[model samples]
Target: MKTKISHADVLDITAPSGGTTSGLAVLIGSLFGIAVTTNVAGDTVAVHTSGVFDHVKEGAGSGQAWAVGDAVYWDNTAKRLTKTTTSNTKVGYATAAALTTDTVGRFRIVPFA
Candidate 1:
């Protein structure tokens, strides 16, 4: 364990263009996580890489319904979560079922999911 670094549940990284907000999803390169603090672009912000969160999800006409344990992906372009895997980063699994009309759902953040 001597070579171990700090616990990685939270990471400090430079914010991307347009900045990042507290309690929102952030996708840097291939790494995806939830912002733990708000910061302007280029500034360092703490991002939580794990745990359950309630976040915005693609809803209704544009997306499909979700069931608990369903794989979830982060749609950075739309700044929301979706069940669609194409061109999206898998962040975690759905912690709660979400109807097609639901805009937000419970998500469990799994590192490198």
Candidate 2:
């Protein structure tokens, strides 16, 4: 018997209230993933659960600097990546160094269900 199913790197998730947009991060409860396709609410959309992704980082004033291996979290309300652990979900870690003024940061998604 094969107990293994899929790789789980990508999953089909129902779009939330505002739906999901391609190339954007969506958080459904504690589980979050990067939308691979855009879909309306209640519709199934492909979401990338794992792997490295370039996402919008919290950039204000001098912005937030992230070094390699720095922990990253998902700010649902802000709909972007942040270093603040409080009231945020642990998404992944920084794969590269980011400047304090950088608008985007590269990070690896640490599949959390």
TM-score of each: 0.93, 0.94
Report clashes for each candidate as comma-separated counts. Answer: 0, 0
lDDT of 2 by residue, 1-113 (tens): 59987898999878999999999999988788899988999999999999999999987564689999999999898888999999999999999999988889999999665
Residue 5 of model 1 has an lDDT of 83
What does candidate 1's lDDT look like per residue over 1-113, in tens digits?
A: 89988898998999999899999989988888889888999999999988899999999787589999999999988999998899998899999999999999999998773
Worst 10 residues of 1 by lDDT: 104-113
Candidate 2 overall lDDT versus native: 0.91
lDDT by candidate, in order shown? 0.91, 0.91
Q: Against the correct fold, how does model 1 do in TM-score? A: 0.93
**After TM-score superposition, what is the CA distance of residue 1 in candidate 1 from its true location, in Å?**
2.6
